[model samples]
Target: MLNSWGEDIDINTTINTLNGVSKSSSSTSINTSTSTNSASTAKNGDTRSSKSSTKSLANSAKLVTKPVSSTSSFFGKFTGGGGGSSNSSNNSHNSSTGTNQASGSGSGSLTTTTTNSSEDTREGNDNLTIQKINASIGSIKGEDIKWDFWKLLRFSNPDKELLKFIRARKWDPNRSSIALTRTTKWKAYDHNVNQIIMDGEYYVFKNEMTGVMQNLTLRKAVILGHDLNDRPVIVVRPKLHSTAQQTHEELEKYVLLVVEELQLFFKEKTTTATLLFDLTGFSLSNMDYTAVKFIITVFEAHYPECLATMIIHNAPWLFTPIWKVVKAWLDPVVAAKVNFSYSLKDLNKFIPTEQLPKYLGGELDYDLDRYTPPDGTYDIHLNDKEKRTILLDQWRVLIAEFIKITKEWILSENQSENKKLWLQKYDLSQKLRAKYIEMDPYLRTRSSYDIDGLLVLE
Candidate 1:
C-alpha cells in the first residue's frame, strides 16, 4: 500500500496522530471526521498509516548503509573516537547491510538477522517496552544501576533516549544502533556549542538595518505548554516571517538551541516534544522553502525520535500543494506522525479547548510579550521590547547552564568513559543527519528556495 509519496496511511494513523489528545480527553471518545476527497481526509486527521513496515527493513536505512564519504555525513568523520578504549566493550560489524557495525566485541548488535514485518514490528515494540521498563527501574546499562552522571547526561533517561532512536529507526535495533553512534559522536563538539549559544546575535535572527535580534513580537515560535505525556508543546507560525536577515546556518543553530533548552526543561518527564504549525493565514509569501526544509531536516535527521507529533493546523488549499512537495522530504514514519487540521473544530477533537490558543477556539490568551514570564510574575507596565529581553536573558541563562553541565561532565570523566559517551552521542546524531541527506540526493544542488518550497515569504 505504499504510495509514491510514502505509504497507505492506516486507521491507526488517525488514532496515533492524536497522541496528544489521548492525554487530555480521558472521558471524551475520539471520532475522526471523514471527507469524500482523500486529501480532505488527510487534512482532517485521516492521515496515512505509519510507513513503519517498509522502514523496519535495514535496507531502508540510508544513513547507516550509505558511503561515509558524503559531505552531509558530518558525524561519519568523527569515528566514535572513544568507544574502543581498553576498559570499554569492543564494536563488531553486523552482517546486515543496513546497520553500522558495533565498535567492539560487545555481544550487542543492532539487528543482524532479518525478520518478517510482523515479527520485526513486534520485536521493535518489545525492545522499546523493555527499555522503557528498564528506564523506570534505572537499569539502562545491562544490570548496572548506579546513577553515573556520565550515563545520565549521555542518556537524559535511558528509556526515553532509546525511544527517540527507536521511533526514528522504526524499532529496528540495527538502525537505532547506527543512530545512537552518530549522537555519541556529536558530543565532542560541546565547546563549539558553548560558543554558539553565547553569540546571541549570530544564533537569533537580527534585523539587517538595526542589527538587533531581540525583538519579541517578531519571534515566530514559542513553547506553549506540555502535552498529556508532559512533553513540551512548541508552536510555530510559518506565516510570521522574521524581518532580520538570517542565513540557513544561523537559523539552524538557533533552532537547535531551542531543542536543547526544551530537552533540558522536560528531561525528567519526557525527552521528546510535540510541534504545532499554525498555517491559518499562511500565503505563498510566507514560504521560506530553504528554512523550512532545514528545520524539518534538523528534526528528522539530527534530532530523531525527539518529535512526538507534528500537527499542521488550518492550512489553506494552497498549502496542500506545497505540502506535497515538502512531504517528499519526510521519512514515512515521520510523515505518518503528522496530522493536518482544516478547522479549529477539527483540532478541538484532539486538543482540549483550554490548551488551544484563543484565536484557534481555545481559552488561552497567548501574549507575544509576556507569554512566559521568567519570574512567574508579569509586570504589565513593562513594554514589549523590555519583556522580550527579559525572556531572552532567561533563555541565555538556561542554555549556559546546560552547556556548563555537559562540558564539565565530559572533562571530569576518564578517557574510557569519555569515549563511550562520545560514541553514544555520535551514533544518534549521525543516524539522524544521514537519514535526511540520503533522502535528498540533490540537497547540495538545490538553492534555498528549492529546499523550502513556497511557504517562505521572499
Candidate 2:
C-alpha cells in the first residue's frame, strides 16, 4: 500500500503479544522469538496491559511537491506543451516612387502580438531558478554527497526532492545553488554525523528521554489536531528536557526523526504547521544553546515554510536572555511567527484548548508507548547502506561471541568432553538463530509449529 507521501509500504509481519502471552489467530498471527530465559506468566485473574512500539522544504512561492503520483500530471500544468505565436512582419520598400504611384496590393494582413515583458521576465527567472537547482543536484550526485543514498536506492522523483534546496534560499538561484552544493559537502565531510545515523546512536539514549523529547506522546512536542485553517499543531514541552541526561547530538537526532515522522502524519503535504513551546518548567539546566542552534538550523536549511505559527507558553523571566540569542538566529519569516503566551487564554487565540494537551489545559492525554506514526505512517525503510550497517552490527556481536567460545574450547586440554558439554549447555546453533531473530525479525520468518530450542540456521 502507498503511504500518505505516496511511498510504497510493505508490512510483511504483524505479531501481537500482550502481557507476555502470545496470541495467534487469523486476525493476529503471533511470530515472537523471546529469550526463553525471560519468560514468566501473568496471573489468570489479574489485569494485563499492552503497549505498542511506535516509531519539508520551502519558502514563499511555498516549497511544494505533490506526491509522485499526482506530480506527474500536476507539474504538466507548469511546463505543458502549448504556447506558440505566429509572427508576420509587413515591410514597405520604395524603389521608384518618383511619380508617387499609389500602388498598394496586399495578399493578407498579418498582425503580431507583443508579450508582457514583466510577466515573461518572471517566467524566465523561474525557469532559470529551476535550472540552477538542477545543476546543483547534478553536482551533489557527481560528488557523491553523504545522504544521497536515497538517490542510489532509485527512489523516484529527483525534481521533487531538488525543490527543497531551491526554496531553502527563497528561490534565489545563485544562493540556493551554493547552499545545496555546500550542504552536500558539509554532510559528506561530517564523519560524526555518519556515526550518528549509521552507528544507531539513537538506540544508546534512554527510552524515556528519547520517547518524551522525541515527542512520541504527542504531549511533549506532540502533533495535535490542526488549527482552524487545518495546519497541524505541534506542542513542544521544553520542561521535559535536561541536557545532562541527553547529549546535544541525541536531541538533534530525535528532532530530525520526529519532524520527519510528523511529515508522514499530514494527510496532505502541508506547507505549514502550528508550533507550541510549553516552557512552564523553564530551568537553566534545560538551556542547551547548542541543541537549540542545531534544531533551528535544520528547520531553516532543510524545512522551509514548515512553520505557520509558533506559541511559546509560560516563558519564565530567566528565559528572556536565552530567547534574545535564539531570536537572532531565526529567519525573518519564522521569527515573525513567534507568539509568547502568558496564559492559556493567549494560546487559545492561535490553537483552541480542545487541541492542546491536558497539562496545557487541553482535553487530550497522550500515551507514548502506544504511539504509532499517526495515521498509518511507517518508518522509511533503511537504504542499502543502512541495512548493511545493521547487519554488520549484528554480525559483529555474533562473531565476538563465537570467538570467545572458540578461545575457551582451545584453552581446555580435553577438547572432546568440553565440546560435548558446551554444545549441550549453550546450544550455540539455536542460540545464534534466536539472536538473529531478536535483533530483527523482518530478516527471518518461522512457521507456527517451529520449536524454539530446535530451530537453527543451516
Using TM-score as the measure, the top candidate is: 1
TM-score of every candidate relative to the true structure: 0.47, 0.45
lDDT of each: 0.41, 0.41
The C-alpha RMSD in Å for every predicted model, in order, reads 19.7, 25.2
Clashing pairs in 2: 218-222
Superposing every Cα of model 1 onto the true structure, what RMSD results? Answer: 19.7
Model 2 residue runs over 4 Å out of place are 1-168, 183-220, 367-458
Candidate 1 ranges beyond 4 A from true positions: 1-155, 186-217, 242-244, 369-458
Give the lowest summed-lDDT range of ten residues in model 2. Answer: 46-55
Q: Write the per-residue lDDT of candidate 1 for residues 257-283, one digit (tens) a residue.
A: 556445434543456788889887788
Can you write out model 2's per-residue Cα lDDT over 279-352, one digit (the tens) per residue?
88779987778878887876777555567788887999999988898999998878988989887788778877
- State candidate 2's TM-score: 0.45
